[model samples]
Target: MTRTLEWNVHLDLSEENGTTKAEAVLDTGSEKLMGHGVARCNPQDVDIPTIGDELAASRAMKDVAGQLMRAADREMEAVGAGPTKGPLGKPYAWTDVAG
Candidate 1:
């Protein structure tokens, strides 16, 4: 069966002392997930707020992706499908974050 569904994502960003931080929120009718990330500008590098925003936002989205994956893993387990083992290859595994 085909179904139509919608989920909303909201992102919040802040910068201070050459550090940019982001929080990504995914809201579903039944649940909400939160993800966070930060980017630090080098002391000698140019302080470009836009670049920092981009980096931090990307990282936050990545965090959300991992969370979604973990959620899927859990559901699959509940159905006796066993570990997700899709990318992380372990139950509720997390994708590595960029450094």
Candidate 2:
């Protein structure tokens, strides 16, 4: 069976304070859950840094992904599915690149 998963993330940015807070929601058609993360500037009152944004977004997504994987694993286990090593391994295909 093919299933569709939807992930939604909301980021609140405070440019003056150099801080960003993110809330993430994952929906697996039948169930939904939430996660959150924050990013802050090393120096207060500076413009938000790109590195910080990247870090926080990545952290939030990682948490969501982990949760989804766990849920899938549990369902598979219940169905007598054998555990597969590297079942989640995949390569990225980028559509855009900067020269």
TM-score of each: 0.80, 0.57
Off by over 4 Å in 2: 1-18, 44-47, 82-99
Residue-level lDDT of model 2, residues 47-91, one tens digit each, is 547766676677677778788877878988889893666565553
lDDT per residue (tens digit) for residues 2-85 in model 1: 999999999999999999999999998799889998999999999999999999999998999899987986888999995544
**TM-score of candidate 2 relative to the true fold:** 0.57
lDDT of each: 0.89, 0.65
What is the Cα-based lDDT of residue 60 in candidate 2? 70
**Which candidate number maximizes lDDT?**
1
Instruction: Note the clash tally of each candidate.
Output: 0, 0
